[model samples]
Target: MGFFPDLPITTERLTLRPFTRGDVDAVLDYRGREDVALYLFDAPLSREECALAVQQRILQTSWSEEGDKIVLAAVLSESDTLIGELSLIWRSEDARQGEIGWIFHPDHHGRGYATEAAGALFDLGFQGADLHRIFARCDARNGSSWRLMERLGMRREAHFREHALFKGGWDEEFVYAVLRREWRNGG
Candidate 1:
């Protein structure tokens, strides 16, 4: 399938590429932090778990089927530092839609790295993958995530109150989406 690229996608200051074994330490460094895992569905990972997660992501970098998920490591071009990650989950082949998500090291926050990486993922989903629509969701309390989604020109489509049990309690969720036509029209 033409769903994935073997080469890394380079942005002005970042490079979006597949995860490698060498990236485990960086992954654990960030993903192991409580702040980073606060909004995530899973708890903070240990060193071994982070290694396995990296291996899983590396495996997902190649998309041989319609439902394959693509996960990219966002590295700072200047330093080649793995600062964060961006992902596009193939939601429906029939609907031509996908879902996106992201995470970054707390140390890399406030630098616009997440937004830049996410925008690249959006372009890949809509233009590269020829998807009809792309959407993202985050806990309602994740102001930074939702704000970045907005900055990427995604419209807030829904706010599900107490959508599901998260972290042992009910939490609201915000959904943001953008259509291919909208993206092409500079949405």
Candidate 2:
């Protein structure tokens, strides 16, 4: 069986599943917004870009080697409405390390969906993939992102100042991580 034999992982309120062509519109709703794209590496996506992105994500459901990434659509279980996206990258096979990231629609902010979804990802990494460590990085100015990381029991491992130029200026970054032992030990 594959790392995650379960295709659609269900949380209390959301489901993390592979992206589909039908998800273009829902995904575009947030990916096309300027505010949502602010901290992201790219600018707001156009319709065509969103469509192509979904096409790419559709094939990113598996992991077999270092650098391989799996992207999942976070959908509201009751409505099957796509509200955000999450990703896990196999950073190192020898170190058993991975990276996690998430981007949710602003409308869904303040809800516990992101935290729940992240926890689910942590499960997949630690249990499903037998990973030793999973980490996440975010712009230091993004309070919500870091706060969510903390809520997931990930500790701030690094604070990089002026890490690189982002959005036309120097940007600071924060890296948060949690070990498999900690995750399994109730934090």
Candidate 3:
């Protein structure tokens, strides 16, 4: 059941592991949706090139001095199909603080896959990575993301008005962060 026998993290319903070149079509298929891409990223990525870029990023993590980035493919635990992606990008200067992001296929959106994957990753961050804080940023307009953050027990720390530039204009963001102490305290 270990799709990533070499990697140090896995979950009952997911596998968080290094990306591969073969993931091009699936990654592109998810990234291709305008609704999924607009609020999440600045631009749409070209399928093959972007997949290669993602692969290169994971490869570079092997040599990273502080292990600031982890890009994981969220595969189904049962079938091992790559359903989506989850990531933790640490800010090296912040000790153990990191930010997380996730995306699933539109068909899988409301089925609690995000919550399951994130909860598993949060534990992986706290216990496996020894991270102190892991957070997620969601657009204020994205009610689904906001609700997901709450369901995951992440408290809203800040709401930035026009926090990011998207498609030549400004957009607001809700920043949610959870600390090690809070997680330990059952927050």
Candidate 4:
């Protein structure tokens, strides 16, 4: 993979940027909610935990080698509100593949924020980072996430049944992906 670009990728309505110390409160406000933590791997975090998480995210702003993960805070341009978070994980150096994921506050749902932010991450992964392929995975039950993946022009590549046990039950997973060529051709 190539070098990661600088911070703060601006969309028409959102800013994709590094997490800051000041964002800790907002992070806890959203991430601490039970509804928001339902599908997440980790349980709802407390203020102290969120502060540490934000600190770690701040440190990740400096792009490192392949396999390093970059986490960006999705903020509303007008209000500068931290609405969500997006991540790109360099999956493989030789294969030039990466994985992307996101989490948004429930209050901001039904809007196009996740779609817009994720699309920008895809563009950065393929065009800026020079990755050959980028993919995303979500719990099959999470209709909104998979739908957003489809809206971003990624094709459904795989579906694993009862993939894992989560939240005291079985969970399926769907994999969606797009290749550099496919992205370039506007697929």
Query: What TM-score goes with each of the models?
Result: 0.95, 0.96, 0.85, 0.94
Mind giving the per-residue lDDT tens digits that candidate 2 earns over 121-174? 999988888889999999998999999999998999999999799989999999
Best by lDDT: 2
* Candidate 4 per-residue C-alpha lDDT over 1-187 given as tens digits, one digit per residue, 9 for 90 to 100: 3465777899999999999999999899889999888888989999999999999998775447776888999999999899989999988888989999999988999989999899899888877888899999998989989999988889999999997899999989999999998984843
Model 1 residue 170 CA deviation (Å) reads: 0.3
Better of 1 and 3 by lDDT: 1
lDDT (Cα) of model 2: 0.92
| C-alpha RMSD of candidate 3 | 4.1
- Please give the CA lDDT of all the candidate structures: 0.88, 0.92, 0.74, 0.89
Ranking by TM-score: 2, 1, 4, 3
Q: What is the C-alpha RMSD of each candidate to the true structure, in Å?
A: 1.5, 1.6, 4.1, 1.6
Candidate 2 clashing pairs, residues 3+ apart or interchain: none
Model 4 worst lDDT window (10 residues): 59-68
How displaced is residue 159 in candidate 2, in Å?
0.8
lDDT tens per residue, model 3, 48-139: 65667677656633314454466778877788777888777766534767677888878778878888888877876676666778888988
- For model 3, where is the 10-residue window of minimal lDDT? 1-10
Candidate 1 root-mean-square deviation in Å: 1.5
Most TM-score-accurate candidate:
2
lDDT of 1: 0.88
